[model samples]
Target: MAKLLARAGVASRREVERMIAEGRVALDGVVLDTPATILQSLNGVTVDGEPVAAPAAARLFLYHKPPGLLVTERDPGGRKTIYDQLPDDLPRLVPVGRLDLNTEGLLLMTTDGELKRQLELPATGVERAYRARAYGPITQEQLEELIHGVEIEGIRYGSINANLERRTGANVWIEMILTEGKNREVRRVLEYLGLKVSRLIRTRYGPFLLGDLAVGEIGEVKQHDVVSFRKDPTRKGGGEAPKLVEKPRPQQRGMQQIPSAPKAPIPKPQPARRITKTSANRADKAAFAEPTRQAQPGRDPVVLTKATKVKRFYDAKPKAGTGAGTEPVAPRAIAPGQRPKVFSPELGRNVRAKPGRTATPTEAAERKPAKATPRTAGKARAAPSKPARVKIHKSRTRK
Candidate 1:
């Protein structure tokens, strides 16, 4: 066999197995039953009833994927896939790193399956940087612990560099850099420490950045840059064959070399105060005591009487100028024919008439109504004469 399918670039040794299972691939007018079943170059091979063509050269691109997109070839639940957001002009590409459905950031995609494998393998050691906003009280000490390592649900996670960027109220923002991409590692670690991850965004993946790349945008890495990245010493061998370094575990005090457990913190004793017998007796009496005065029948309630007295006391005096319970009194009304002893203006001023004072007949006669002026009298007489004359003239003219 010439490895005819592989020569045609239809798929790799692994994908051919999957294609055979799907029944879309056939050989010599018969569908292939298994990947191991090989044939000579003369055997007819077809995909979707059409002859397969050789694949073009591989290409790589950097995509800024927004949240709510699934990083999969197809989702069984009919969820929107990253493929749906890819431009129509783009070739079929596999994501180098996966961003969860709720995660948004830099995602690398490649047309060649071999390149995808190379980038995703642990050997890549590609450092992924993320900016995370967490809600809870986080201290610099906690961030330093993250740099060492953290155990989550019995799974031991490796060291990661985390820094506290800023704190606002109960929420904090942190910048984290990790080489190994674990599933929900950042979120899980923070949650284990009683913190809530409110937002997560990948700012950079290796050398590629998400800067200014709008959501759903796909950008191709320059050919020269791709070549340079492949040769980068930092990403050399694609995280494969990482050098192992032995870490010294803390020693135990016993003769045997047993792993020592963290020591339990020593608690400090609080101060004890001595209480006197008199003070205790007074407190007991106060707690059990009742009011000394008993209620009287037909009397206002004690609370009501107290409230009424307070209201009256406040109302009688000006709030600030006069002292309480010492307001000035207003004068009382006087009865008729009883002269007030002291005639204050507010009481009512009195004007007494002089004795034997009478007006004479001449004086009384002089107070007559003043006569109307000649102009006024003339106008009054002329008003009635004009109406009478007009009526008489009309009767004469008619006769």
Candidate 2:
């Protein structure tokens, strides 16, 4: 019954249990007095004579509780409570846990009572931290002993980690962390050590920090952060844990740290040789030098390489009247002191013969001057020279 009312957003599970014990809860017109009554739904249930509304989306707030403000809705002594300090437009909210009037710092408030119950349960193992300004002659060893928690008035505290900061004139700042938040835990613990606590500020609750939030001010945790905290609220600050960032690996202690990427080896520098203008000119001349050759005839009269193959290639082509058809005739290679043959048009053939052979008179006689064909026999007559310039003599007989 209590859980159902809480799930319905009537109040936190613990608060609902308290209300049931007070006979303020009823089911189907019957006043209920026990939280153990199990019910399927809140179809006709009433809490404090009012219908319970359906559950709402989870919302959370981080409030910086200032000293002297009670963390309650009402105080019998007419003292100021946390609700009076909140904005009027704020939604109905319940503190996740109590921060006594004298204690100040981070106090988580939420609209989802179930979430409040989840976070406040000691089984969740959420850590809470407080920095106490105490006047005492405390030592590090004395504080470390609190790891094995101490008991006062027959009530035992769970393990706590306490550390002492610097001291000035018997006034010291001490930091203590504990998973459970028993009432007046920090003050009583310090007082047991003969130290008078001047102030008690809870600097951390679960995973949330007090940070720079001013006194009596409130801020909200983002929805995603609240969801993450509800998923695993067992961390320090009772909320999302601080992101664990990897620290860059530093130089190894004993052995030097190895470089991730190999360093490029630098090339050795060479001594530059100094070259004079005279030496430079000599080198340029040598690089461009040509071996002198004896001059050959039928070759360029100037400085040029002889192109013997080019002339041979063209000469190898068959003459137009060659009887060999289109077959290219291999040119007879003319050596030094040798001459190429000529074509004999009168003979109607090329008369190239053996090298060093002299032609006989009969053969020479065989070569005759070519006779013109009819097409070529008739010569075109030049324009007849203008009729010889004739100046008629004037025959004026004694005129």
Candidate 3:
């Protein structure tokens, strides 16, 4: 069946069905007439007249893929592929994910299709690091903003830890780390910020690094390291971090029993002490008590007020040219321990400037009366109490 072929790594289930329909699948030297035929074992199963091989052991390899090589197994244009650069005697391996033809660096490969699918999934929370050379004018502040994430062409990218490494005129270098491996995500995000990426190289993937690995070189991950890596979880609260693992070697001891240490018992939490109403009231009074002022010999004692009273800081220096009096304000006292129900003066703007105008407290407090102008001097005066019109008319008639 198609499931058997897929499990054997011949092709996907759907692809196996397609091959069966095309008469490419056979059993016992006879071409399969239909996909409905079932087989429990892959002993006599074949595809395209080729025998189906047994599933290979789970193996992982780290490859330093070159820039021009395609990550896929085949290219319609007959271009060079990642497999072409791999060393001989290596098993048939599948890439974890596809890297662009021009983008190069750490690329993971595995012999098991299931492992490839697990690592390739975005939910794995595997981080990919890249160093990009771009051309534009940018600052550290601008690159730091990528932490909050950015939206490009209606596609939103996850949080990126981007840092500006160096700059040479319009050309600059930046380092970026992101969890989502969206297609052309890095290039698109930089381009959105008015930067054109010239070259991009992935330096790290998860805990694996491409340190000093020459282009087209491949290396196998140690068995113990792979086990440790596979133990890591992709979701929050899934499991703990990977433990330190030693290199694999022949076992010296066999069938020996070792006991683990006994764990200590956890202590139970104690109940909190409850504060009485009278104690709470005392604490409140202590917090709100104001400073006391000693009474003068002949003057009444100043009763200090609670925290609810107004407190003002008056500047004592007078204006140089105007000679306005800058007397310090007298301290006003309220009854001791008196907590006013209304709001304090600080919260109340006593003299508010008109909207669209700004006025300081000192200017509002030191304002003076306006003086009359020359034009309004005569009009501002009162008229004569009695009119002398009758007397003036009689004198004129006599003249």
Model 1, 1-399: lDDT tens per residue? 224454345655466677778887877688777767656453467887997665555667778788899998789999999887776655666677788888888888877666666676667777788988999887888888887888888898878899999998889999988887889988888888788998899987777667677766677766666666767725532221111122234557765865889999999897986889998999899989995876897794656433444456546645563465666655777677655554445448754433455789888788766787756644645545443333457447321
2 or 3, which is superior by TM-score? 2
Leading candidate by lDDT: 2
Clashes per model (N, Cα, C within 3 A): 7, 9, 0
When summed lDDT is taken over every stretch of 10 residues in candidate 3, the lowest stretch is 236-245
Candidate number of the best TM-score: 2
- What do the candidate models score in CA lDDT, each in turn? 0.72, 0.80, 0.77
**Runs of candidate 1 exceeding 4 Å displacement:** 1-15, 26-32, 36-46, 233-399
Please give, for residues 1-399, the per-residue lDDT of candidate 2 as tens digits. 777676566766778889889989888889988889988778788877887776667887788888899888888999999887787766778888898778888888888767887788888888888899998788999999999999999999989999987787879999999988788888888999999998888888787887877776777777788887777786444444332212233456699765699878999999999999999999999889996878787785766676665466656866685747566668768887765677866688877555777889988887756777654557785676655545556653231
> Model 3's lDDT to the true fold?
0.77
Better of 1 and 2 by TM-score: 2
Candidate 3 Cα misplacement greater than 4 A, ranges: 1-7, 12-17, 26-44, 49-51, 233-399
Which residues of candidate 2, in runs, are more than 4 Å off? 12-35, 46-51, 236-399
